[model samples]
Target: MKRLRLAAPLAAAVVALLPGTAQADVTYPDPQPITGQEIIHDPTVIRLKNGGYVSYSTGGVIGARTSKDRVHWDDAGNAFAEPPEWWYEYNDTGDPWAPDISYRDGRYWLYYAVSSWGTNHSAIGVATSRTGLPGTWTDQGKVFTSETTDTWNAIDPAVIRADGRLWMAFGSYWTGIRMVELNPRTGKAAEDATVHHLATRPDAPYAVEGPEIVKHGRYYYLFASYDACCSGVNSTYKIKVGRSTDIEGPYVDSTGKPLLEGGGDLVLEGHGRYIGTGGQSVFEDRGKDWLAYHYYDAEDDGTPKLGLNRLHWTKTGWPEVF
Candidate 1:
């Protein structure tokens, strides 16, 4: 098994000491500013068993944050618990991006990717926590690598456990979205497995990426961010979706069109001053699904920041955000 070494016990102990200093109450997905400084991108929030929320994101030395209210946040700071020793071996300049959290088997598991924009040399790393908070994390290191320097870019990983099987959806740029099965116990890709391409657009210069899968009403819905992102005020990103009866999909949009044929129902796009909104993670709180994403804060001179909106499912089973 390939592994990446994270920092030692010092960092983890420091983070563990944090939750003792403050306490807040968890609430619904309210529209509140969680991070007051730096650009927060690729936000993934999970509800811990202890009744708090933990959020992880991209591009900073800090890997996770803790919040009692899901609005007010405190930086747990660098839960990688180790230096870049392992990640540096893979790509020295790449930053850890878009961490997805899942609680299973009496632990909190974080699956994340490391890569720079437009590069295929990306790898997915994992860390586990006995307690879902910051300090208890045990970095299990690299579980899989794209290693596909020529054909496809592998980044933006999201894992979903459905029908007693663990499935991973990931890809970007070169060949679009792809899925493969993983060994549930180890959270590693199955050996000799083939990746199935779920979405692609060879004709469009802009690509489909950031694959996020969620099961709703006997259908597996794959939500992907389309086109370019991270251009600040000039971004061109949009949210699109396709659904299929099977977890491994031939996902189709509402018109009975396959996603491979460029069929997607547009969910959210830039409005007025807000430019290029996409890269979404949907979460259900109190029976209502909320869309969590980052967009340029148009009012603040177009500063890129995280935003939240309540997701409404239409009568036809499509999703929309108000």
Candidate 2:
């Protein structure tokens, strides 16, 4: 299925709103250029032990791209050259969506989503590696599936540790963001679950998805991508954020509005030069926070490519693009 597309005029309007906005301290690659293939989307950049970066993203096959300077990337080929047999057994046709890589408990875990476009029958699967690189990954099998077709559509898996417990926050389309505790040692959901409705907009052309969480100071912030994300040059994808003192929360925006009520502080939008700047994930490097996402390069013949910018937190504790 073709991905959802956004209206051109509306996308342009959102881009005009950005500029001179709050920014965080960050250093961009001297000359920014498209680093990987055009199909790369929902990228997760993880700093390796050897002081380099490895990225994973959505595609039919799990693939890897490496960067020495975090600017230029070299495709390391498919991490899983073939789709896991189990995924094929469950669903005859398989297309892997976003994959988030994390290292914990002496293992490198890759949590990924599998589904066909525009469908809610999605599942989040897991793979592991000892070296956290391509060719070394081993599929550990599916971790969670969307049990309730009426409520939440599970995809875009992000795992975080809070208050001595491991938790995962994931959802898309059907409702909003939902979280469940995980047994960190097993990388599986815990029995005691606490789910939160992070964001929803029933009146908009699109709904909330792509929940990427980070803890700063005394608050846990949830950053999500909203609107249509795959319309090529017509995409309206933008980044939004809400925060709370607790992990599973009634996260609120700067205006003191709960995320479930369509409240979010805008972080990145199409700025006329770049269209649909969302599907973001935060990477903290060298004591600074960097926003990694994909956007259509307006100047580069309008192709979707990976982009990175630094995130600045305002004195009042609000985050914006740098």
Candidate 3:
């Protein structure tokens, strides 16, 4: 999720950055060149109302940065400065991961995950702000959570507004992605609602997480990361996608394979010095689409860095990153 698809800073030859494809292909492409403030994981960016850009990512305190041109960046500081009092209830280490940011109803809503790695003990929480700047957010407490007894883990929260309602899609390593209805007035799960199961691998390792949904034309596309991550150069993380008519989807790939059965079309993979590229968000700015994610820099000994690229819709209606 991001700001309204309206005005944004213009770059030279935006069309050249997004090459058109008449047909979808099996192979993925490389990201565009970017420098400055590279270290980021599970990054989400949103354009400020004043035309600047702000980004948040996983860290001990939720790392943040600001960019006037969307290329050169400066550290803006963390949302909490110190961990919130309630964070200790979910994560003793006080670390957060995979934050989702969006503008809505006169405030910026940030949803993030709290849990130890490789465990179902987790919680999804939210913070709200009027300016979206650092140290301004007010913690709204846990939106959702899970325990060892649950079939799904509550992490990697990706919220989107669709069908006259706010929906949050999240889960990791237990079953796959799950969605629940959120009250538009409070940004919390609605009372007496059914949780919708979205996607899963279902095989050994069952590697699927980081679900993001975007609507284009007649279809709503679901994008997710597959395989292991945080293994340095050995990481096998890649991005895949599927589409559906409804937000709560029986999503299918180009070959009509159901996402519920481990079906997805390849969107991006590691190339050259970039390795383990996954955890993505999509947004449109100034009539052009962009894909944002993180990649481990093989040349820099697996340090995660920000990666951005122009996204184009093929004549076949599938998205390709250029």
Candidate number of the best lDDT: 3
Query: Each candidate's root-mean-square deviation in Å?
Result: 12.9, 6.5, 5.6
Winner of 1 and 2 under TM-score:
2
Models 1 onward score TM values of 0.84, 0.85, 0.90
Q: Put down candidate 2 lDDT per residue, 1-322, tens digits, no spaces.
A: 0011111221111122236764332212211344555446888878888788888887648767888878778878877878887676335666688888888888889998887666677778888998899889888777777754447776899998899988888888787778777777778764445565667775643378888999888889999998888887888888888899988788888778888888887776675567887777888888888778888877776676777766666666766554
Which residue pairs clash within candidate 1? 6-82, 7-81, 7-82
Q: Tell me the spans in candidate 1 whose CA falls farther than 4 Å from its real position.
A: 1-38, 148-150, 204-206
Instruction: Tell me the deviation in Å of residue 141 in model 3.
Output: 0.7
**Residue 121 of candidate 2: its Cα lDDT?**
72
Question: lDDT score of model 1?
Answer: 0.71
The TM-score leader among the candidates is: 3
Model 3 sits at a Cα RMSD from the real structure of: 5.6
What are the lDDT figures for the candidates, one per model? Answer: 0.71, 0.74, 0.82
How do all the candidates rank in terms of lDDT, highest first? 3, 2, 1
lDDT of candidate 3 at residue 182, scale 0 to 100: 92
lDDT of 1 by residue, 156-274 (tens): 78889999999888877776888878889899886676788888875745388888898878888999988888878888887788899999889988777888777787766676566
Sorted on TM-score, best first, the list reads 3, 2, 1
Candidate 3 shows a clash count of 0
